[model samples]
Target: MTTSTYHGIYAVVSRIPRGKVATYGQVALLANLPGRARLVGYALSALTDPSVPCHRVINAKGEISRRNGGSEADEVQRHRLEVEGVFFDSHGRIPLELFRWRLYADE
Candidate 1:
């Protein structure tokens, strides 16, 4: 993806409020790049900005996705969410109905 695409993704991601989460597909669509959910994940993985809050973007299943199947980053993301007053259920997934950041009116 171009740097501009990543910038657009970053812009949308930066808007996700504390204690709320958006799915990768949601971020991709909000950034005007439809059907580029994995691209959103890639851009976020590449981002180094502390203000972006990439950890706030979870999977569509409301589960924290692991990088390279590693739990270290997943743990950090979960901890950050917890610190922001977002709770995880016994299944270790965020309840999307409660914590999803829906930008659309009809969603």
Candidate 2:
């Protein structure tokens, strides 16, 4: 992805509010790069900005996707989400139906 695409993904990730989550696909769509969910994940994984809050992006199933680097990254993401008061189900999923951001409808 180009630097612009990476920044676009990060920009969308940064907007995810606390206590809510958005799927990678949602972020991609909102960023105007439909079908780029994996690209979104890639950009988020490369983020160095402490305030980006990339952990707020989950999978379609509301489960944290495997990070680019492996388990350590995934663990860190999960911990960050938990710290933000986002609850996980018994199966370790976030339950998108409950926590997924409804965008304009929510605002």
Candidate 3:
């Protein structure tokens, strides 16, 4: 993807509301980049915007990706989620059935 596309994905991810979570696939799809979930991850991994809340994204299975090279990134994500009152199960996966964002039909 081009730099513009990456910026577009970042914009979409930035719009995700607090206390809600979007999957990597969801952000990609929302940005009109189907099947580019990993691209979304890549974009977010490079994120520097404090307002973006990039940590609110995870895998489709509701598990935060451990792509930052260690458990430290995962711990940081979990800590952020906890700060937002997002409870995780014993397996460290968010219960998407309960906390997943319900995007509007027109969104």
Candidate 4:
């Protein structure tokens, strides 16, 4: 993807508030790149800026998607989310209904 595409992804990701999560698809849509969920994930995986809060983005299933770095990355993402008051069930799935960010026009 172009740097512009990645920047667009980052811009949307930066808006995900603490204690809430957004799906990859949601971020793509918000970034005006609909149907580009995988691209969103790819862009996030390529992130180097600590301010992006890439950990706040999850799968539509509300599960932390395994990265190229494997379980360690997943664990880190989960820990960060948990610290933000987002919990997962025995199935390792977050309750999206409760924790998924409902973006408002003001945000």
TM-score of each: 0.92, 0.87, 0.89, 0.93
For model 1, what is the error of residue 89's alpha carbon versus the real structure, in angstroms, after optimal superposition?
0.7
lDDT of model 3, residue 80: 94
Candidate 3 lDDT, 27-57, residue by residue in tens: 8998999998988888887877777789999
Per-residue CA lDDT of candidate 1, range 67-92, in tens? 88555988988999999999899999
lDDT of 2 by residue, 14-90 (tens): 78888789999999999999998988877876778888877788889989888445668788878888888888989
> Which segments of model 3 are wrong by more than 4 Å?
105-107
Q: How displaced is residue 36 in candidate 1, in Å?
A: 0.7
Give the candidate number with the greatest TM-score. 4
Worst 10 residues of 4 by lDDT: 98-107
| lDDT string, candidate 4, 1-107, tens digits | 47999999999999888999999999999999999899998888788999889999999999989966455978988999999999899999999998989987225
List candidate 1 stretches off by more than 4 Å. 69-71, 104-107
Winner by lDDT: 4
Candidate 3 CA-lDDT value: 0.85
If both were scored by TM-score, which would come out higher, candidate 2 or candidate 4?
Answer: 4
Clashes of 3: 0
Please report how far candidate 3 places residue 95 from its true position, in Å: 0.8
